[model samples]
Target chain A: MAPKSKEKPKAPTPQPPPAIEDLFASLHRNIDKSDYEKAVKDADQVLSIAPNDEDAIRCKVVALIKDDKIDDALSVIQSSRNLPIDLGFQKAYCLYRQNKLEEASACLRGRERDPETLLLEAQILYRQGNAAACADVYQKLQKSGIETAEVNLVASLVSAGKSSQVQKALEAW
Target chain B: FPPAFQSIPRNPIVLDLAYNCITFPDIENRMKKTRKGLISRFWG
Candidate 1:
């Protein structure tokens, strides 16, 4: 008969939390799976090590928005080390999504020159039923000599000024 | 909606509903602002 081994079996070691790169990979995986709350937690872990990381911060905001925690998202940016004003687009978006049209409209008030802010403002104005104002934003974007699919679409909506067209265009995007 | 997302009342095939909790059944409910903003920022 063979002798039994005297060595005891080793227990599995507890693994540390994933490295930042692995955490980001997990973040995208969670997002792809539409487990947004889990994605938020992953983003939080990423932010814990790199508090001012733009990608991590943006990921957190996006996950919060996806998880329908728009208010918490706004607070997340506000409480971050980054300046809240720098995230006007995100704040405006949260308000816009929450149907606080007036607040959304006001959030991008001073950023009219920024192309991103211009597009977001145009959308907010359109939702507020201020087509003329929305058209003005499109025109300004055109005059700025910046061109893109979004600008072209915004221009088309400006020309049509139809609510149904606006809805369709926004939806198609 | 969260409750509906969590679990349906009096549903037998509860396991089938498990997928709904982690997946977006409504595209319209996806955060357009964040999605669009992120894409625009990426390509803009």
Candidate 2:
């Protein structure tokens, strides 16, 4: 008589956290709709679970900016000392929003001359009403082939006398 | 605007708002004055 074969038990399937994805998706939707408070709440929930989550932190900052909480936004970025380059750019942007032209300029100056950083410098100049200087920076960036949507948009706004629009465009970027 | 206007202001509120906060009535007023001055001096 053949010995009866023992059946192996199947492993349990992992269940997804509906809350996490729902929160994240809600954050994105709020951002798209410019509902900053809701975005911040969702981002905060995500951050509580994953403190080092860059995307969540960024969303929080964006929410702050949209809500016109520039100081709070800058403080958040400044508190995060070891931020990545993109976040660094965002911090610089917060400075620009606050009208700290020199500090904002310094932030970009300390970093490598990438398209994004150069755009930030140009934006500071534009906001300071240095149209010629802003144009010069844009020209240089364009010559370097580092033109992004942000750079182009700032250039347009500078020409149109809507320099503050740069912040809005950058946030969207 | 002009290069002269690019000079940074000495006001603490202006400086702090420029480098720290999001929106300020003073900054907006200053920006309006600067823009108007720039327009009149250069564009006009």
Candidate 3:
């Protein structure tokens, strides 16, 4: 009689945590270098595993912005607002990018006084050729002692007749 | 004075830096560290 063969258990497939982490790391690198397409690809891979990752969503939005797809970025950010309050500023930024000045201002209105938001509003006004209004807002922000990079840049714009550059700078932001 | 300038509403810039979520020095430091980690791994 033949001896009964012992059955062996098959090994479980390993989960892909390390690979996901590597993908995020690569995405972060691409973002730092302003390589939007590669960053978007890496973020997509991470999102495949963790579909609702906040950082991944942010990376994808940034890539969309870098690609000059402002409307798409706005949509992504608007959808992300359901996640958390910290994402509110990002949503406002998307609105700004889409040239939805009123909506962007509304998103930021009555929030705690954010210097960046103020500067962003001023930039939007400048883009609309409301130079005096933009300057007034910039002066108010300056008087409030909120000396952010955005504030400085806006101040320069107000003084330099570079209103056209405001939109470009906001995009870079 | 132009009518636009005359009608320019004065929106007071609220001064509450504490409540504003502007990136502070500590946050900047953390971001730098994270950037460095990513750069070291990928760009190095």
lDDT of 1 by residue, A95-157 (tens): 877779899888877774566677667666766767667656665655444434344445445
Over A7-71, each residue of candidate 3 has an lDDT whose tens digit, in order, gives: 54645767746566677667767777878888778878877888777777777876776676767
Q: Rate the local accuracy (lDDT) of all candidates.
A: 0.63, 0.63, 0.62
DockQ of 2: 0.02
| Highest TM-score scorer | 3
- A96-153, model 2: which lDDT tens digit per residue? 7777878778777768876667667766776776766765666565445442534555
| DockQ of all predictions against the true structure, Cα-based | 0.02, 0.02, 0.04
Q: Given the true complex, what DockQ would model 3 score? A: 0.04
Candidate 1 local Cα displacement, residue A71, angstroms: 1.5
Question: Which wins on DockQ, candidate 2 or candidate 3?
Answer: 3
CAPRI tier of model 2: incorrect
Interface RMSD of each: 17.4, 16.0, 9.7
- Give Cα distance to truth, residue A62, candidate 2, Å: 1.6
Clash pairs (backbone) in predicted model 2: A70-B22, A98-B17, A98-B18, A99-B18, A100-B18, A100-B19
